[model samples]
Target: MNRVKYIFFGILTFSVINLYPQINRVMGMGGLTYAITDIDYSLTPYNFGGNPAWIVVDEEETLLDITPNFQNSWGNYRRMYDSEGAINYGTAFKGVKRLSSKGTFVGFTSYNYEVVRNLYRTLRKDAYTGEAYYMIDTTQGDFRYTGPVVGLTYSWEMFNDLFIGVSGTYQITDGLKQVYTNAQSIFREVSINAGLAYRLSNDFVIASNIKYSDFQETIEAKDVNLLDVEVYNYKGDTYFIGKRGSSVTQKLNKKRFEYRGQVYVKPTEKLSFAIIGNIIPEIAKVLVPQNSLIDVEEVYTDFYTIDIQAKSQYQLFENTLLGLKVGYNNKNGWSNNSKKNLLMWDWNISDFYYGLGTSYKFDFIPMLIGAEFEISSIKADSSKYIDSRFTNVSASNNRIRVGAEYELFEDHFIRAGFNYGNDEVDVLYGGSDVKKLGVSAGFGFRLSSAIYVNANVQYRKVSTEYGGSLSRGGLSSFITLRLNTF
Candidate 1:
């Protein structure tokens, strides 16, 4: 059997936040749910305050998946074992106004998490008499992820019908949790964003935004050969591979830019239509050099590209909105590793996703409810060097959101909501199914005509077959302040 698959997932699982630290990794419901199902609309709201009307909200922001998603990228902030529980936290907020020719806005966000949960890994080893038997589903140690982000943004109208905006940010992470080159590591990256918006006419507007980032990650690998698990033992003597998380595995110093343009038309006072297009540069990925792993000198690079989305939104009524999004994502990737040690294979992948949703505001209490459904197909080509374990992993998802916001007294507002979904994933060696639920509550205050503040708290839980055992969860709380001018 190829050690690539075994070693890859093994080492990769321990890799810090971003490498496995993904956009929605906590939603991986034991092959039952896809990471995409566990998504957050905002990172966290500590920098800005509440609003009677919040355009974004999600449950996973405070519910750590305890999977590689958060642990692989920014696992440093994790304060406890996530296997015993989880805490995913994040928020986003900004306020702006056209002050004659100059516009300015300030906002802040943060996302931190910690989760400890159980995993049922079906183990397989060649047995005597050429017989293969299943090993006991083992319970490994717990894991975690935590971090914070802060930023400021500004915009200026350069000319008639033209506008420019820029954003600067500072990020801090703790407990970086990825590993590459046989080492324990950490992950942290700082990035920038800018965008442009133009008015075609009184009834039309178009806009696009781009971002740049560079971060480091370090990885540390333990000598499993001496651990309690008999299955992982090798030679008696073991040495550390040094910390690779700072620059190995998932810790990528990326310089990618994603641009999107949208044109909105207001043909009449009551009806509005909008369409959007996206341009995503190729993804940049670099692997750990063998020289850093086992004293072997080698390095490699992998580049991939995709133009993943096309979407549209329409407003039938002033209080009702409809949205449709489709993605022709090509998770296709390339590889260029020349080292003849153990990490060389065809790194090709392609995946696609289709989604649709609608949101409405109820008149009674101004409640807002949105629901989305999606289907995905992510797969790889089988080759001698390719590990087909994950070939059959695929999934479908159905999401429903129910939320209500009401003005408590004038500009002050309160909100509460819930979310539910299911996902399935192909983990190469094995796959599982998952289901989850989220609960959230938030309040906002309009301090003045141009300033506002908001606070929110949320909790989430996931359930799946971990030897048919039930798992615990975590919670998150956030606050944000926003300033707007006219």
Candidate 2:
């Protein structure tokens, strides 16, 4: 005999989830290199001083950078299953050209590209009872996204002792995912930035910037299916079989807006400080199966993220510099469906991080050295959720890095460095933790006064307390050449 059971399963569970450090020199130092100019302009859209001022008559410079990275990771989920020996590799390119002519106003354009850099996951569950009975249940999925970004910036002297700059960037990403169902998505991002720098005097300068960004993503899924079956023994030699079926289609959307501001001050030739703030508000909408399990309804989720950071640097001597950075990031989620007793829900996450760094240049040896140490305290809050009403979980991360650069000849360089870090994220996973260690070396050669080539190699390993480990070691090379109108 055969029996059929209809499982009113709502197919509404939608889940969604690297700058390599160093050119030739910083990779050897442990991947902790910091620059006020890169941090300010790259993150906040504020240019400290124009790369080339409005008055300078030197030819504009064009820069090219290429970076490729590889990683191998192994981990255990719920301590019940483990994925071992997974490898990931990706490559990124950036090119920037100054469009303004020599002895004229300054403007530039840039482009960035990345290839085949995405993630995939799978899950399967099965249950069966009785002799000669078997059941199979499985689901596999892939989330792939790639981006091409274009940016433009213009800077000119507004007046004597004052400067102004404006920049804009537009990015588009193609997102594709296939579970038991197939989905296609598109994401768009736009940013605009404006900044002003005023030199009150030679001893002091003030700079500030304001930036706005908009992000939107839409996803459509078709033909999602789920299956559950049971086989049991009847009386003597008779057997019975039972089966359930579920299928669905869904549409999901996410929209987010962000605003950022930064302020920088250099009160003296050797002292400088900067502060940055960011605020982001996000909304998510998705189609979910109704309680009866036959109809679909729309659900909304809201969340906000805020980040604040402060950094300061001091030149202790003519050849030595020291700096410190501190930051706090917070995320809060609110749910209005308080009455629904669901097994899974959303929670909030927060992280606080601080670090100290120092660099030194030897006047006599023609070499440079740098080092940094950092710590982060991470916490996950889910007390408001029904499943985690009683317990709170927390973790911490600690890291250290050191590197050095030596001039092998005039305009030629060689460098090497090593780093170690511990991510204590298993506080609730039987108190087991993960550790990371890596070492790297590289060399650079100047083909001409304006052309340079750099290459580097790194050996890295990640090991868990459950006897699972991952290793990634490979050779990566990139060339940087500049065009000048000298």
Q: Which ten residues in a row have the lowest lDDT in candidate 1?
A: 124-133
Each candidate structure's TM-score, on Cα atoms with residue i matched to residue i, is: 0.59, 0.67
lDDT by residue for model 1 over 9-56, one digit each (tens)? 321112222311222212221111111112222111111111101111
**Residue range 1-486, candidate 2, lDDT tens digits:** 000000101111121102322244455445655521223222212432222232222223455555555544443322211123334444545444554432233333333232221222211110111011111113334345556656656666567767666667687766555544444556677877666666666544555555666655444444445443221211111222332334333333455665655565667777877676778787654433454454342335567889888777888888887878889988756433312423233455578999998888888997888887889997865433322332345779888888778898997888788888887763323233667687888777778765666666666655554433433233333333432322
Q: Candidate 1: list runs displaced more than 4 Å.
A: 1-100, 105-150, 172-186, 208-210, 219-255, 279-299, 310-313, 317-321, 341-343, 347-390, 407-409, 424-430, 445-453, 466-472, 481-486
C-alpha lDDT of residue 236 in model 1: 9
User: lDDT score, residue 377, model 2?
Assistant: 94
* lDDT of candidates 1 onward, in order: 0.41, 0.50
Taking the candidates one at a time, how many backbone clashes does each contain?
91, 4
Off by over 4 Å in 2: 1-25, 34-138, 141-147, 159-164, 175-182, 194-210, 221-252, 287-297, 335-346, 384-390, 426-432, 466-486
lDDT value, residue 164 of candidate 2? 67
